[model samples]
Target: MQTTPEHDERMAKMTFASVYPHYVSKVERKGRTKEELHAVIFWLTGFDDQALQRLIDEKATFQDFFDQSNLNANAHLITGVICGYRIEEISNPLTQKVRYLDKLVDELAKGRKMEKILRA
Candidate 1:
């Protein structure tokens, strides 16, 4: 396996809602706005605030949330290192997607202008 078996055990069962607040908190702590965080999320997941809220409200798992939402056509454009793992190189599809969001949020937290985060 290109990634470790533990990677599956690590994130296969994580809930989108469970990790979402941390994303928000991390960016907000960096003096970034919630709207910027939401923008990156929407850019990747194709969910507006309401749909995302519904999924979070229902406590959707990462798999469930992604299975239902349309991944952005441009999400592949987001590529970088996050938490020491290259976003484009993570072999597990789910973890890669999750980390893609993480990278976007990290960029937002670092104040990497929203346009660049959105790949605009």
Candidate 2:
């Protein structure tokens, strides 16, 4: 999947609140807990339960959400393919960050050990 500027723009406009439930459901359906999902999210974005709830309430766009994040230094360690894009090779920083989150959730759903998934 080639990520054109149009695709990036669409992704940037996506609301965190909109996709959050699907993330929760994806993990939960695979027997992962919401706390585990939260852990993954926290590791990537530094947003806790309260802050996440606030973002959901405000319906923050992905751009706004990531712009406010203190992205983890280890986020660079998140390398792999997500949504058909290789995380490390992605040139768009925000899109890479989004894929990083997706990849983390995928790992969680696959029952990967938390230590490895968080690149600990």
lDDT, candidates in the order shown: 0.85, 0.93
Q: In TM-score terms, which candidate is top?
A: 2
Off-target runs (Cα >4 Å) in candidate 1 are none
Candidate 1's TM-score reads 0.92
Once model 1 is optimally superposed onto the true structure by TM-score, how far is the C-alpha of residue 93 displaced, in angstroms? 1.3
Off by over 4 Å in 2: none
Worst 10 residues of 2 by lDDT: 1-10
Best by lDDT: 2
Model 2 over residues 51-114: C-alpha lDDT tens digits? 9999999999999999989999999999878888988988888888899999999999999999
Clashing pairs in 2: none
